[model samples]
Target: MKALVTTEDSGFGLRMADVPEPEPRPGQALVEVRAVAVNRGELSMMAMLPPGSQLGWDIAGTVLRPAADGSGPAAGTRVTGLADGAGWSELAAADTARLTPVPDDLDWTAATAIPVVGLTALYALRHAGLLLGRTVLVTGAGGGVGRMAVQLAAASGARVVAWVGSAERAKGLRELGAAAVSTYDAEETGPVDVLVDSVGGQVLNRAYRLVVPGGKVIVYGNTTRSELNLPVDWGHARPGVQLRYVHLFHELPAHPVTRDLGFLVQRVADGLLDPQVATVAPWTDAEPALRALAQRQVNGKVVLTI
Candidate 1:
């Protein structure tokens, strides 16, 4: 099958040739690929790996085969979920337990964008305690995870305030149920019961001031400037709010209850979790999308259709 391979010089190149189709190796399943999301984590992995290595996790496909031990996905189910590797192809293999069924109404491009971002949003909001009557501020509100964060917070009944970098995204954020939209600096003036930080650097420091004394602050991704500084006043007085940062991969298939990928996938099928896709490119054009992701030119998750 034709697949996009990372080139010798840290870029994606199409390799239209015979590549071994992945098969379920005990506790795994083989999926007939439909679409996959291009995420920052995959981009960062690309930067660290040698040429021709594939990197991606979110996949929307069909279960073509299940393992003999009956530990893999049942064959012939339309699915959308997370996996470990070989994600940029027409066929991929993953542990069956990792697969999640996709609702028939949603397209693969949308399905491909759900897993990691939605899971991160779930963790961030879960950390924020009693979300129903709270007010939550989401920084980098327009990006993939941030966009999902806003919706999840609102679904749990939190009054959502989204801080977006561009004015154009304000309308979309509001449509997703954000109560208000503002720039990072401007959004800091409001009272926040919880803060979800996607952009790091000064924006994160700025968010620290908005949280109510007993509130919570969760940082799941750093999309802004990488090097971040903490405000001295954040810990200066009062029994300060809780500050916790997370990486989605760190908790996957672990932590017992909260790490339930099955629950997450069920939510996707039920429309409780929504995937926001910024762009979709065929496998042949995935290189451009990868370049755009690396250049920080993308607005949300980019989907590569196989």
Candidate 2:
């Protein structure tokens, strides 16, 4: 099978290579990957991967075989889920517990775009204890996770404030249910009951200060990759405010990832949640697709069709 693997070169650090197909374990299913979504997190760690290492995590495909333990959906079921590795390949062995059935009418690209980001947004909101009538602020609102976060939070009856880098990117956030959309540099005069910060650095610092007392700030991705410098007196000023860092991989076991993913999939099927796809390119065009993501040229998820 051909997969996008790590290369020795700098800049995106990926190349197509033929690799052995994955073998399903007792609780895993072998999937014939139809499409894969590109994420900024995977691209950021590309240079750190050993040469020829398989990349990508989110994928949508048909199950060629069911789990040996007979714990999941049957063979031939179309599903979308996360894989530990080699998700960019034509085949992947996914844990049956984490897989969610994709709706028959959903496009493979759209389905592939949901897993990682959708789960992240859901988990973050849950961590923040978001409630109806609460004001929730989502940073990097134009990105995949941010867009999902905005929609999910709004659907939960929370007032959603979307923060993006540019007005152009903020164009459709309101339609996603965001009560307000503003640039990252804009001042947030009102306090929010919960905050989801994906774009660490100054934006995160600003978001931290916007949280109301006893509210939580869930820090997930650090797209800016810069150090977060909070005020020296923050602890005294916001004594009960909780600061939590969310890493989906670490929280997968404790949380019902598959169940939550399934619910999100259903929402997408019902047109309640949109996995806004910025680009859908052939698998052979992985290089350009990855380059677009690395350069932050895409507004939402980028799916590469196999």
Among the numbered candidates, top TM-score falls to 2
Model 2: what TM-score?
0.96
Q: Tens digit of lDDT per residue, candidate 2, span 1-306? A: 788888887455777888998888899998999999988888777867789888879999999999999978788999999986779998898998889998899889889999999999998888876469999989999988999999999999999999998887796899999888889644753788898898898888887777777888898888888998787766788779888899989888987777889999989989999999988899776677778777777889999999
What TM-scores do the predictions have? Answer: 0.90, 0.96
> Taking the tens digit of each residue's C-alpha lDDT, what string does model 1 give over 15-111?
4445777666787778888998887877777657776676668888998887667874578888876766777777888766667776677678877
- Scanning candidate 2 in windows of ten residues, the lowest lDDT window is 184-193
The regions of model 1 sitting more than 4 angstroms off are 9-17, 255-273
TM-score of 1: 0.90
Clashing pairs in 1: none
Please give the distance, in angstroms, between residue 227's alpha carbon in candidate 2 and its true position after superposition.
1.9
**Global lDDT scores for all candidate models:** 0.76, 0.87
Q: What is the lDDT of residue 2 in candidate 2?
A: 84
